[model samples]
Target: MYTGNLSNLILNSDSYKTSHWAQYPSGSEYLSSYIEARKGDYDVVFFGLQAFIKEYLSTPITHQDIDEAEMVIQAHGLTFNRAGWERLVDKHGGYLPLRIEAVPEGSIVPVSNVVCQVINTDPEFYWLPSYIETALLRAIWYPSTVASVSHYCKGIIRQALEKSADSSDSLTFRLHDFGARGASSQESVALGSLAHLVNFAGTDSMTALVAASRWYRMDKDMPAFSIPAAEHSTMTAWGRDGETAAFANMLTQFGGAGKSVSVVSDSYDLWNAIDNIWGGCLKDEVQNMGGTLVIRPDSGEPAKVVREALERLAVKFGTTINSKGYKVLPDYVRIIQGDGISPNTLGSIIDVVLKAGFSADNITFGMGGGLLQQVNRDTMSWAMKASAICIDGVWKDIYKDPVTSRSKRSKKGRLALINQTQGQPKTIKLDDLSTTDNLLRDVYVDGKLLIDDSLTTIRERAGW
Candidate 1:
């Protein structure tokens, strides 16, 4: 009854687009006639037949392919259905719907937390198990990954800010979700990046624009406002003569409306480039035009380059160029370091840069690839198992062999999750069947999803 735009979206998205349909036995029909008769009551089995059929229908598979695939899937579906149907019908006449309680999207949850739960309403609905596995796993895993990474990046930004006295004056840089396009699959790139961008404030205007238009119903031009706000930001090139010149020309064109620009200085001889080419007239021109200059170090020890640059600037402009009282010279030009900047590397870089008498506030980071693609397996692990079953008019929790690698173990009977804040955070799993205190709530019920979140909303909630 809470139907609205979400329901319409789901239905429209799920509906068959082509003028084609597949015929299959109804779930009830299969259960009563074939399943119950063949398999005895009170058995546990996975239900995936309908889901397989639905998946096949959604594709551009030819009729012949569908028939072949359906033959194989239906056999498995019917086999499980027979076992599961007899158990549910003869024992605990299915009454309860499956209940699932999961962490809200964008929340950073630790390992061993009950990130999700799946339960059945009627004992008979136990047969619906296999049908929901992939969806349930994906619903939790992808968002959790994005949330965890976003949390890490937030910490990095916080640390960088904390090391400086004038942190308030430091640029609040955007966290671009550049990984989505190059690293992930096409569909995932579109949706996953949107989901990531919800938490990571991306500098990639195009991704932000697309996410805004599709998910937020806003125009693509919204993020353009960020360009001018970060107008004096530096640009980087390969540090080669040709690369630097090309990049400078492009920046000149891009900053045509009197925008300030920064150039990469380490292409040939960084000292020569800065002291001779960039340090002389170009620096004067940019400053005279009321624009700040920035120099980026792409290769060779960043600390050394930043130290030299800082020393040069301090000697050249003893009073420093204070743009709006923010101290643009001495520490005038910003130093941006790009390659291999992980948490440890960043900490080391900051220590060195600070030691070299450069204000930590005068530096910016352009991190890509490394931060986004790196995954520490120890931080997260995934597992799926059969949690419950109806046996002889009773629902029993299923447990697995503790020592076995594939031990699909779960707590017994109707499980309730109790969230108790005692010192360190903890979750107590209760086995009492009578207690419904912390039963999992439904995120998607009766094939109707309960939540439809946008990337922007996700990003805001994630606080990245």
Candidate 2:
């Protein structure tokens, strides 16, 4: 379960108090009410705090046990009381609104493309910077990482498919996202990786189904597989016994339901089991019963296992049995490869499988950690420097950097982000608002969010 302790830390931090320490105008009263109503929900408070503490604090605090005495004193100092917080909220006008020109959620964006931007909801509440920084950064980083990797995998899959002779079979490719339960963070594991898969246009509907049910208000029983004519689907079952009754029972169950069964065939002696159970017995049963059988090799060298399985199928089921298309008996029994498949390994396996007279279409890939844990180490550093502060009806750029480095300098004057989609890329300085043809549009105005794009919409926009 995801404990929202990070949210709590942000709410109860002195930095938050310092940032959103002002009052707002009449139009932005909703922001004020929101902060007031949820002031005492310490769980939410702790959730916000977790992010802040992780970023700012030198030492770690146990999420299981927080020091209450220290918390009370810190909360008091941070102005957590009703009156003080209301005063702060009123001063800042209840919320800070950010106008961002992000590279949409799923797009394969390189480093230095402004992924997002944040600003005050009310111009007067510009002081609320530190309070929002943690959440904003955390939200963008991991999802972007997953999306980038997924985009790379798409290229790899396309390349593999291009080298195949049977182009018709490429359309039925499956890419599964098996990283959710093992991702670095629980939020990223569940939500961020789902965003990645959705963006990549993958066939793993289970990830999307779970995300929709949990995060968005969608029906849980929504089907994962669909087609215009027939509803084709895949079902997985595992067992250790080579020719035991358990394997027979499962085969019967799968065959009875009019669904193709993919059995894990390498539990005992992989070669022996395939010959005795799958090739000798189950093959005839499934063929006579009008069912398809798929053998899954979950261990050892994928190429070797696939070659051995194919040879066994040929000898036992007869060399004349067609393994392609939907008509023949052995055609129903295919090999699905899993376990420790990296990009390089997958490439090598494809080479070997095709060389042995087995078409690339004969195998299925179930990839996991190699794609998920892979990182593009390129660093894209982001810093929000104070651009301008108003004083006595005059605005001036506020620039300050304690350590001066050539690359770390901030652009001065009243700045506006000019995005020229048609022309050459350049940053132009504007002294007056009317000077530029296009300026950064307000995404969130007066604490009311204007850009409300759904996850699916964002995923499509990613185009991985």
Candidate 3:
């Protein structure tokens, strides 16, 4: 009897799901459902399903889990399907008799297209597909929404870099993940940060690194990188008078040839730190550091502060015009706007910096709550709905047409995601398309993980 109090898959769902096994049609033997970003601002970056599978679904549910779940369900005044759960444990060894097909991890699928499809493999477990919807939908939405937001930010940065810089070489590091501390949990940060890493290669989230290594097979080559950087505590510990000393220590410790380090420079005052401290007293040291000293401004409106800071830094440290006619910060100096950044403001900040005649390369962003914790499931309008069902071995189309909200109208029949060759993928009837043409691949089948994707492969699928 496995008694470890870790998560039990049987109980990892909404309480209402406990009674769903008895509510399905009398002769129902299988249920087919699909998940998609119904309609949203950005295409879904299909990702993190592999992590969900490895973490939750791959493990066999023990008889101990069934017993414990039944006890809890009954106590909650919900009907527990003891017979169904016991049957699953005995017949399938607690492995879900379901097949999960999804777009390859990191594939950017347009909104309203199927990102994942679920169907129970065993005829006896008709409710299994919908029963797992709570976990399955959650596993897809949060990470995919974060990835979509990150991808949107990347697009904004790409446009800025192309217009203001000589090359887009610095694009990957233009946005850094400072989201670990702001996330709700270590698991949340791990998944959220990994989503950001799909488009960018910088992060301070250690859990994301472990997640990528463990689930995405990034051990041999780590996917994300972060430089030694200072925070408020580190800078403020020196007192306002000792702020310059603290900044100097950071450069001395982490600065070297062809290296990078970040230091928060707005402890007492942003203007004084840039003008007197960094530009006046420490100008020589900064210029001679043989690397980049990324100065971070934590307060004030991001766009306005970055524009002002760039002007002051240009006056003191000097800047050269790039090939794109934008002022490029010297090799040793840069800026990072870490506060108050979101999808709306990130582009605005970059636009301000670029419009000030500074190259996009002169500034990077460190996002905290805006990157990880700000979004919810509806940010992408994600939902999983039952689309088809098999009753007494007869398949039929099914859907929910909610008159209250036309956007909530669910897809119908067994679905297949097929690339249109010119535009985004289209969700069509599975019977209408050949299996080879379907973008949705069988990633998980009856407890077996079929596609073990690496972070590199996923990145490539997301356009790197």
Which candidate's TM-score is highest?
3
The segments of candidate 3 whose C-alpha lies over 4 angstroms from its true place after superposition are 1-6, 434-436
User: Judged by lDDT relative to the true structure, which candidate is superior, 1 or 3?
Assistant: 3
TM-scores for the candidates: 0.64, 0.64, 0.97
Residues forming the 10-long window of minimal summed lDDT in candidate 1: 30-39
Off by over 4 Å in 1: 1-99, 120-127, 168-174, 180-182, 205-251, 256-265, 289-294, 301-332, 376-379, 404-419, 422-425, 430-441, 454-457
The true-versus-predicted C-alpha distance at residue 408 of model 2, in Å, is: 8.4
Candidate No. with top lDDT: 3
TM-score: model 2 vs. ground truth: 0.64
Question: Residue by residue across 421-443, what tens digits does model 1's lDDT show?
Answer: 44221234545424434523345
- Sort the candidates on TM-score, descending order: 3, 2, 1
Worst 10 residues of 2 by lDDT: 37-46
lDDT of 3 by residue, 225-315 (tens): 8898898999999898898899889889998899999888888898999999999888888889888999999998888999999999999
lDDT for model 3, on a 0 to 1 scale?
0.90
RMSD to truth, every model: 11.2, 10.3, 1.7
